[model samples]
Target: MSDESNQTEGPIAGISDVPVTLTVSVGRARPTVGELLSLTADDIFTLDKSLDDPVDLYVGDHLVGRGVLEELDEPGSGRLGIRITEIAPIKDLV
Candidate 1:
């Protein structure tokens, strides 16, 4: 088959720039009622994931990618950000 025949159209060209929500999951924890109620300002709750593990990214509820968490330092701008490590296949997003 010719190259042109093998190539199918991709997603609608105009919608690529649309905004979407991307989530990064560090981990999950189940807290008991007593634990939840006893929480204070200095309390720290541990998550299931470790520092070296990659975080999962989600749009709405569907997973779209995975990335690593990073901290940024630029004078007054101290924010946490994600550096996408791997993106899910196009088929998977659909």
Candidate 2:
């Protein structure tokens, strides 16, 4: 077979269009079962991380990246976004 025939059109051609769910872990709270069940409206559940901590980005159980939480500044969008600070190696991701 010719080399051209074996070459892919582009890097990640087959999987580039694949849709994957990316999860952003802002923080975690370890509330007791009683505390969780007894929660009422307007309750403030505290997280283990502070506002300045970097959030973790995960694809399935594997950690893919880390980023800081940000609020989008588009007029009235008010959407929450993440600013990627660190990324796991490609080998680690797969």
Candidate 3:
């Protein structure tokens, strides 16, 4: 194989700077309409997964990967983050 033939553009070369939303799902809850409406300011809706379980990472509505939730102890602003553990199989996305 020639060098020129082997040197092709990468898949996401042009749109590399484009922004995408990534969401991490810790778990899910099912609530009835009345239950949802009855929620108060101090009320809590619990999720199914535990803290140690891996959370699903979604790009839009598509689940692209899974990760673990982590906390960042910044001096001024403490924030939450995720550490990616595994990527979904290509077939899984489709």
Best by lDDT: 2
Q: After superposition, how far is residue 10 of candidate 3 from its true place, in Å?
A: 5.4
Lowest lDDT 10-residue stretch of candidate 1: 1-10
Which scores greater on TM-score, model 1 or model 2?
A: 2
Candidate 3 lDDT by residue in tens digits, 16-77: 45689888888999989999889889888889999999999998899999989788786546
Candidate 1, residues 1-94: lDDT per residue as tens digits? 3455555457644465568877778899888999999999998889999998999999888888899978778755769888899998888876
Ranking by TM-score: 2, 3, 1
Candidate 1: segments with Cα more than 4 A from true spot: 1-12, 73-77
Candidate with better TM-score, 1 vs 3: 3
Ten contiguous residues with the weakest lDDT in model 2: 1-10
Candidate 2: stretches off by over 4 Å: 1-13, 74-77
Q: Would you list the clashing residue pairs of candidate 3?
A: none
Per-candidate TM-scores read 0.72, 0.78, 0.74
Number of clashing pairs per prediction, in order:
0, 0, 0
Worst 10-residue lDDT window for candidate 3 reads 1-10
Question: Local distance difference test, per candidate?
Answer: 0.82, 0.86, 0.81
